[model samples]
Target: MSSDLSLQQIAESVTKSVLNATDKDLEGFQKIIDETIKVRESHRNLQRMIKSYSTTMIQRS
Candidate 1:
């Protein structure tokens, strides 16, 4: 499978695995939330990098 497909599978697994829980799962939930936030920030950075690279290429061309 492609990397996107793999990631989707992993995300689905995590969602399904935690769909039902209680206060005892707080630690697990916190870790997931933090990881998700980090992933989102990383994606934003990647988008910015790509935008900058394309802008420079367009200017040079």
Candidate 2:
């Protein structure tokens, strides 16, 4: 399986878990939320890095 597919699967599972969680599951839900935020932040940073690198390459040509 590709990394993208795996990540998508993991995200789906987390979403379902959060939706079905009870009050007792608050800690689990919090962990999921935190992980999601970290993933989003990482993704944004990666995009910015790639954009900067690509822009530099274009300018160097």
Candidate 3:
């Protein structure tokens, strides 16, 4: 009976640990996704600026 209890306790601990790790991983993924979005937006803005400058230069020429 004691052995059974010990096994159950071990199983619960392992389950909790796995769940915590999964949560941490999800948080990391979300941060990465957010950063990637910001980077993409910045890139788009830079491209727009470059395009506008090129057009202005062409008009001047």
lDDT score, residue 30, model 1? Answer: 88
Reference-based TM-score of each model: 0.62, 0.62, 0.64
Q: What's the CA error at residue 13 for candidate 1, in Å?
A: 17
Weakest 10 consecutive residues of candidate 3 by summed lDDT: 1-10
Screening candidate 3 with a backbone cut-off below 3 angstroms (N, C-alpha, C), the clashing residue pairs are: none
Worst 10 residues of 2 by lDDT: 1-10
Better of 1 and 2 by lDDT: 2
Candidate 2 per-residue C-alpha lDDT over 6-35 given as tens digits, one digit per residue, 9 for 90 to 100: 767878877877788797797877887899
lDDT of each: 0.85, 0.87, 0.82
- After superposing candidate 1, which stretches have Cα over 4 Å from the reference? 1-24
Which pairs clash (backbone N, Cα, C closer than 3 Å) in model 1?
A: none
- Order candidates by lDDT, high to low: 2, 1, 3
**Candidate 3 regions with alpha-carbon error over 4 angstroms:** 1-21
Per-prediction tally of clashes: 0, 0, 0
How does candidate 1 score on lDDT? Answer: 0.85
